[model samples]
Target: MARTPADLLADALRRDAAAPLLTDYDDATGDRVELSGTTLANWVAKTANLLQDEFDVGPGSTVALALPVHWQTAAVLLAAWSCGAAVLDTATEDDGRLAEADVVLAAQDRLAPLEEQEPAELLGLSLHPLGMGMAGYAGPARDFALEVRAHGDFFAPYQPPDPADPGLLAGGVELALGDLVGTAQGLADRLGLRPGDRVLVDAGTAAEAGPVAWLLAPLAAGASLVLCRNPDPARLLQRAAAERVTATLGVQIEGIRELGRPA
Candidate 1:
């Protein structure tokens, strides 16, 4: 029933702010983080403030992303939408989208190549476990972690994006800001995402499926996420059981049904 990303977030927060909205695990580092709706909203708010105040990003502004699936990536996506900015996934640099982006946010490791392209603005994320700034790297790009934490934990967009304004651009798909929630809701139906469902998603699938399937669909369906990065096959079953995962993506867990499977 939500018309926009902000509306969806507000509805979800009102539904259950104390519930775990996104639970993240990184087998590569043995790290786990659980964020309640309120906590995730706080992060979103801060990032939105950073985008709006510093970069003047709004309706027509395009924010290109070059990062993996992580908790911070969720915040960044939500923040950009909240500020009424269009997000473009920069998986292929030769697409020519990066050349026109108002700002580009990339992982520290991906900065060197992006800098050579000379985008209008570039920000680097270290993807630090503690949310710290880039370490031991001298790059022309601004540090996202160092700047984001200083922003206010609240944001108000200068101009709310119209329903017709572009919201997400990936590959050949383009969606309007107003149609985002609807698209997510439709995907939830196809994926069989149900309210309060604890869904497990692997990093590779999230990357390939894009945000519509991995992130927004879950939120739109009123479900929570158990996102695993660098998943280890040996620990897969144990982790799913521990997380109480009811549905899965990318892995064939016998007891749990795979998302998008025909009933």
Candidate 2:
């Protein structure tokens, strides 16, 4: 048996060294990006190095992220986990709550309010290159792209924490390191999800079965996930058929209800 660590990112990197692990689609621009296991691991490592060297994010540190659903968000989340830092994922754009974080990673639009929070460090990921110029308007905000460019491509992986330590903490909810491994293993066994299987996730941030069902669960199973930005039944069905999705996670919304209907 392989060694189980507190960090899920490290476990994922070790298991699927060269497999394709993340698939992201941008509906606004119709842009699609795919990150193979190796490429994703490298990017996560580089980002982790930047966070550690520049912001001093490491074990026992807490970083808050208010990012949209995108490839960069996944990279940042994994990078934080790789460094053994707890992530605080917040959907609301409250500066007061963001201030409590040691470091804040947010989108450009959300940076202004957080400026007053006086966080230890702030990094903004622009949805597009045009937004980079706006970074100067916000005090102490740095461009995430520029920072990543300055760092070398290599990063020494941080030492893994004990299985009993906290690996992922969301708001007040804490998941033990061992529980995360068990959850991943359980998801794999229950879903019969494999490396090539495609999973469709139709819910957005509002749904109970949102990020965990769509992003984390699929990745944990070494499978690809197709995110449906909106709850359009027709579009959901079209994408499901197009992507040949094997499993789906969503509310009993219109789209999911349609899937359950017999032909």
Candidate 3:
């Protein structure tokens, strides 16, 4: 049976329900949170439902995500993909680009300036645990956590999009849906990825090597991905040793520089 990218993730969630799919660190609070496969799937489904019901974002629609490296951002990306919508990962809030998207997902701090332009509908996702000082904010924005909580755990899966259709568009280049899946599969095969394997991804965003190498590849191979904000040599080594991260994606280094191994 041919598998779509979303299907691959769903399958992994079913097989390894308790496996850690995402681990995010909060530097300010000094807290580490892990979202298991099942929990991640639940959040993705809820977020997808909210997008579908509220914004009418589905097949052929595009959603712009302008957020930092956080768990909510990852959930939104997966949710957009699950809805068969193409995702535009951009940092800057360009009016022209925002005008083209069906919806925009951004942090609460960035919503004010975006609202002034009236480019597109905005949804605020708060990375901070506390909800203080966000009382009067308005303008087509919905709370990420509250919206997800409102939807039921079950979400009707969207039909898989055409493999040749556009999945992501960076700059002026369109990345075919099949190309994304193929790249993910190729990396997984080359890295000997398998079920139950934990892979650490040291990249920044979905537009970078993060999604394809860390997110897509592991999901395609029925494994899990660990996302890190900063890839410090010592921290990475420690996490790899403690978490038993079997595979890593990023720059190649000669020997173990941090470990004092001879080059």
Candidate 4:
């Protein structure tokens, strides 16, 4: 069993590098992007390198993630952990946690409120479908897309994080690196996730459930994801069929077995 998210990713690379790992769909904007295991790993490697080389992020560094449940968010989370840094998810900006972080990664639209707080380091993400840099905006934050490209395609942390070291800080929850991996494996089992399973998840649920449900669990179980944002009810069945979805979460599709339900 994997002891960290990075280990889970390495396992996937060895087991299914060519398989589709993430399929993101935004019903509101009609945007869709698919990433294979190799592609996702490449992004993760680049992100980890960016955090380590440019920002000097390593073991014990704390990164506040303020982005939505998108594919890029997954890469950021994995990269942070790979560097042995702790993640503080201020998705709701709960209790001004972002002020406590050593670095902040936020979407462009969320940068306004954070500007006043003035975190030591801030990286703005456009969340563009093509993963492009922010357009025509002068902000106090660095552009993630622009800086990330300058980093190497591989990462090697100067100091690897110990399994018992802190890995996440969310609200009142504090989890160690080992705890995150353990919980991920448990959640995967509870959801009946298995190799070759293409799990379809509602984006709203992914956001609400946090990384454990929508990210780590799938990786730990060796499964892929089809994350749907603002899914149209009328087209849900057709999409599921076309995607060959084998399991689901957050949406009640009659014939599709919901995760954790009795078989």
Candidate 5:
């Protein structure tokens, strides 16, 4: 069993690197992307290297994030965890403390206000389905998509993260990094998640559920994820069928098991 976010990904790679681990669907743009376990790990490694080498993000560092529910967001999160850095997600927190973070990564749309906070270091994610650079934007923040590819696809943190270190800060609540694995397992059980289960979750629900439920729980359960953004209500059933989803969050589909308000 995985004891950390990094361990969860390593376990996935050990099990079947080629297996699809995360599939993203954007109804608004009709975008679909699939990431195998190996591919996702590679991204995580590259991003982790960037964080540790460039910004000196490691144990005792905090990375502030103002991004949405997306695959790239997943990579950034796992990377931060791999470095043993705590995350202050703006999705659930205030910009008042964003400037206190060592590094801040934000989506283009959310950049203006966060930029105003004058973080020590700022990076922008295009959130492109194809991992393209931010287009038609002139900004001071460095581009994450371009910088990450230059890093190696393997990571070894200079300072190993201590399990007792803070892991996440959201809604004024704190959780230690060591507790994440256990919390995820408990959430998985509450949601009735089983190994190899396919979960379909909408972006709204995922955002509300936060990373522990929408991201870590599925990983902890050894379940693959199918995340939908800007979900079109009419296509829910068809999309769920196409994804072979056994469980759903934040949406009701006939015959599919909902996460039962656990998220």
Candidate 6:
């Protein structure tokens, strides 16, 4: 039987609980955050609980993601899948597809524009390192950071996700949960990612390559991510060395093999 994305995450949690799963850096903001497999799973649990309890998201439900490639974005995507819901990529224009989502999770910057769409449930994420609420913004949407903290650390979904259910909705394409896992694994293999590989990626490339490259590929390969946003080219070599990056996706670094491309 083909495993679901959630299952893969769970396996990572059990196998490498203490290993660093994600190291996020935003050079433009001078912000950095690292999450271990266990910590990442805990965040996923809390977000999943919030989705299932507050919004009644479950199998067949759709959650539109309007955020960028940040650490919090990973939690939101995993949480939606944990609740047996399909994740709709709203980063790209898709006509009226976003309007059909049961829930919309957007960054604070996108609230005003999304308000016009009037989704059934809108959640605004601060994307702050401390997970704070949006400042001075009076909006109809719920605050994701504030609400997620109130949820439990561990999640046991009332109904587990079915492998056959739609897991991803992107630009008119709907991929099943099993298909998502399969493709992720295939991408990982094609990239020659080995276990324990540390893959460095830039936010621009992550956003452009979609979730398969930014998120699932690393997970499927048993590798970790060093996700950099607004990276300074001058400091790229230093950062890659500090992170012990074995491979790179978006940016080319000296002495590191470029994944999915010839060195």
Ten residues in sequence with the least summed lDDT for candidate 6: 90-99
For 1-263, candidate 1 gives per-residue lDDT tens digits of 33778877887899999988999999999999999999999999999999999999998999999999999999999999998888998676445678589989998988888888888999999988768899988979999999999999878889976777899999888998888888999999988999989999999999999988898999999999999999988998998898899999877787898998865
User: What are the per-model C-alpha RMSD values against the true structure?
Assistant: 1.4, 4.2, 4.0, 1.3, 1.9, 1.2
For candidate 2, list the clashing residue pairs, or say none: none
Give the range where candidate 1 is weakest over 10 consecutive residues by summed lDDT. Answer: 90-99
Off by over 4 Å in 4: none
**Which residue runs does candidate 1 get wrong by more than 4 Å?**
93-95
Put down candidate 3 lDDT per residue, 1-263, tens digits, no spaces: 44446776678767878878877654445656688888888878888888888888777889887777676777787788777788887767654686578888878888877777675577777765332224556657777766667787767745656666566765566665667788878877776776667666554643364455557777877777666665565566676767767655553323322111122
Give TM-scores for every candidate, taking all chains together and pairing residue i with residue i.
0.96, 0.78, 0.82, 0.96, 0.96, 0.97
lDDT of 6 by residue, 1-263 (tens): 77888987887887789988999999998898999999999999999999999999999999999899999999999999989899999675333666789999999998887888788999999899867888988989899988999999999989989989999988678899888899999999998888889999999999988897789988998899999999999988998888888999888987889998864
Backbone clash pairs for candidate 4 read none
Mind giving the per-residue lDDT tens digits that candidate 4 earns over 141-218? 999999998888887889977788788887689999889989988989988988778899999998888898899998
lDDT comparison, 2 vs 5, better candidate: 5
Query: Which tens-of-lDDT digit does each residue in 101-167 have in candidate 5?
Result: 9999989777777777788999999999999888877878899999998999899999877778888
Candidate 3 clashing pairs? none
Model 6 residue runs over 4 Å out of place are 93-95
Q: Which regions in candidate 2 have their CA more than 4 angstroms from the true location?
A: 1-19, 129-138, 187-195, 203-211, 231-238, 251-263
